[model samples]
Target chain A: MTTQQLTQQIRIKKSFLCIGLDVDLTKIPQHLLELEDPIFEFNKAIIDATHDLCISYKPNTAFYEAYGIKGWQSLQKTINYINEKYPEIFTIADAKRGDIGNTSTMYAKAFFQDLNFDSVTVAPYMGKDSVEPFLAFNDKHTIMLALTSNEGAFDFQTLQTNGTRGEAELSGAKELYKQVLETSKTWKNAQNLMYVVGATKAEYFTEIRKIVPDSFLLVPGVGAQGGSLSEVCKYGMNTNIGLLINSSRGIIYASNGTDFAEKAREEALKMQQEMQQILK
Target chain B: MTTQQLTQQIRIKKSFLCIGLDVDLTKIPQHLLELEDPIFEFNKAIIDATHDLCISYKPNTAFYEAYGIKGWQSLQKTINYINEKYPEIFTIADAKRGDIGNTSTMYAKAFFQDLNFDSVTVAPYMGKDSVEPFLAFNDKHTIMLALTSNEGAFDFQTLQTNGTRGEAELSGAKELYKQVLETSKTWKNAQNLMYVVGATKAEYFTEIRKIVPDSFLLVPGVGAQGGSLSEVCKYGMNTNIGLLINSSRGIIYASNGTDFAEKAREEALKMQQEMQQILK
Candidate 1:
């Protein structure tokens, strides 16, 4: 999925929300647990209820992985359902994957070819080879991690590097994250590459947008994590409405009652409505 | 697995090698493709044949994830088999995962809780929040990608950030990777934290080791990618012999014939021999 297509979807839907399917069996309605695959059962309802309200559906790999083989099967079923029923909606395998070259190529095949997700979130610390393999796939998008919203983010990401004076003098004064954004953009055009910027750090958006104006930002932590939608949209939105604000537990587990699906839709609608106002 | 335990196993086995289970259906022997689960069968055969020759088994998640539900199942069976049969051998879920806080917590659950891998590769681009969640698990190790062996690694990892004006400002002139290593170490003392430094980038090892002398490093891209094993060991090795050199295609897919497992064992033996010398 190119940045242009993602922007088109956002504009068409009048929404920039990506409903995260961090489906945990323990958190879902107790009734669904009776089914052979509770995770899939819960995901089916959530997707069916909120399909139209969202431009993208992010199935975090961890949630499915928790249940072992059964969990992985649920993940496959959910993605297959979305692909067959709502082909228009973009899908993201919120699997933060990256590795060496040949290994990464296999990973690219797993998410892009086997699972059929439009994009997969990737970690950039392994440098380029671990990530570029994901980018090599023409149609698939690779969302690199940028400024994240977490207390520990201050640990190393913001630290200063001690490079030789000769190399340091040329690149100008850029923070570590800024250099990552700038350098990652050079791997490919900003077309297939997007970035995961946490909603809590919306203040950094102004500076981030300046670095990669056209790239889509997959912003998580909005609903349940206490990140404000208004703040994220204010600084993060681009001309293409380049923002995928994700709400996982806030929407998926909004109501653990029998009307879980309905409650999910209500929660999604609430965010979508706010996003609609922001896009306008 | 801790560096001491890993080194102990390496010493006992007289090997510093880690056999990478990057099992691809196309690359495996044709006969295995006829089995109920081809990837798992291939991996099982390779493990059975080469368990005595190596100290660790690193399964690149991409190969498993590419096959969808079945692929993930194979991954589980392979890991479970290794953990149960060879409790001493370290297991690495070569799934480079890193994301925002909540999302990262889920990823940690996937690999650590559900899958039961000893370590997982993570990207440090999003700063602490994206990575700290993975480090929270006391038993499991979080292998952050420090410097990769791919062409794109040069893109962002080596890019020069702004430094002080006249004097070589160690405070200001930080490469993105240097910051990641330094900051990530402080997250959870160096105990559960490791870095993925490519074997190809041996030159940078002296500097990297200076900053992170105690942390373990999972070095990939050695045989098939042409990364020098000796150079990597010379500079990258820590006081604890903190290095796990991974060789995937060059070892696992060394042969496509019916004696694939035997061939894999032979290839593993060759690398293990070299690693044994390096450890000495």
Candidate 2:
């Protein structure tokens, strides 16, 4: 889907929420285990129950990959079901992939061509060539990691840069995350770029918006991760509402019982309602 | 495999050469396509012909994942063949995975427990929590990307840091890669850790060795990417010969004709011979 379609979906649904379908089997209802493809069944019910409540579904591939081929099949089924049932809904393969040139191209093929996700989260550690291949696909988005909402964000990200005056002059001796945002914009087909800026750092949004004011930001870490939606929107929102706030466990695993889907919708409704108010 | 077992293998084989099994169908022989599992057959042939020549096998997961579930199956088969038949060989799943704390644990289980890779490459962009879960797995290795061999390495890996006087004091206002090298050493199970220091940046290894001289380094970009093996060994080698220098396409796709496996063996033998001389 194009950015216009995604923007339209957000408007029509009155929500900018991206429900993360990062399902874990051990956490799901015990009864769902009896199904032939329990993961898919669980996801199917979740999408069925809550598809209208959100604009995007982000499946962190690690959850599906942990189960091996069976998990991949479930992921395939889940995405296929979503595309066929609701093509307007944007999809993200939260597979933080980045590799050398040719290798990165294969990954681009896997997520963009093979799986058909609207976007895939990519690590910027590998630089331009690692990312440019993904961006080469004009329609698919490449959400690069900026300020990750984790304790480790302080490790290398928050560290000030050691660039020479020539390098530092462009972006100042700012944090590494800011540098990633600045440098990425100059790459080929960068118009297709988005960013994964963890919502936990709501304050950083004010600074982030300055770097790429127009690009979409996929904000993870909403409910379970302790990011306030109001603060995120207060600083991060653009004229286009340039954010896709993601909620995973708090929404998908709202309940593990037979009524899990309904309960999930309840949780999603709460988010969608909050989002609608924010949009208004 | 433990570091001790890895050391034993390097010593036993008299070669620190690591063959990267980054197989792609287009690159492999057309004759192999007729087989039920051409990838596995190609890998099996390569392994059978060259197992004794190298100490480790690193199958980049992208090449498998690009083919979808069938590709994942081929990957499973490839790893199983090596583990069952050539138990001494260290296997590196060049999957470059890292996520949030909980999600990272799932990745650790996927690569270390489910897939049973002895080591898996991880991106350090997410910080400590994303990596510690992988480290928590006793005996398994987490090879973090320190300084990659690709052009993208220049983007972030080479950036000088804006460390405080205190941090700069510890590791100096070092480049991002050195900071990664220094910070990773402070993580739990640092002993089980390794770094992916690309051979193309062999000059950086001299600086890298100063941070953590003892930790093993998985150096890619050997042949196909124009990295000199001798230069990597000169600067990076430790008393334990602590470098798994990877040569993927140069060895694996040595030929696409009837003698593909033989040619692959020849390429492997050439590297092994060079490695043996270096060890001597």
Best by lDDT: 2
Q: Give the DockQ (2 decimals) of all models.
A: 0.46, 0.70
Expressed as tens digits, the lDDT of each residue in B184-258 for candidate 1 is 666654568988888878899999999988877888879877799899988888777888888888878878998
* Candidate 2 chain B: 10-residue stretch with minimal lDDT: B163-172
TM of each candidate vs. truth: 0.90, 0.98
lDDT (10s digit) by residue, model 2, range A1-280: 7888778888999999999988899999999999899999999999999989999999999999999989899999988999999998999999999999999999999999899888999999999999999999998999999999898988888888854432454545778888899999999999999999998999999999999999999999898999999999999999888999999999988888999999999999999999999888
Which CAPRI level is candidate 2?
medium
Q: Residue A203 in candidate 2 has what lDDT? A: 91
The clash numbers for all candidates, in the given order, read: 8, 5
Point to the candidate with the largest TM-score: 2
**Candidate 2 global lDDT:** 0.90
Interface Cα RMSD in Å, per prediction: 4.2, 2.1
**What is candidate 2's DockQ?**
0.70
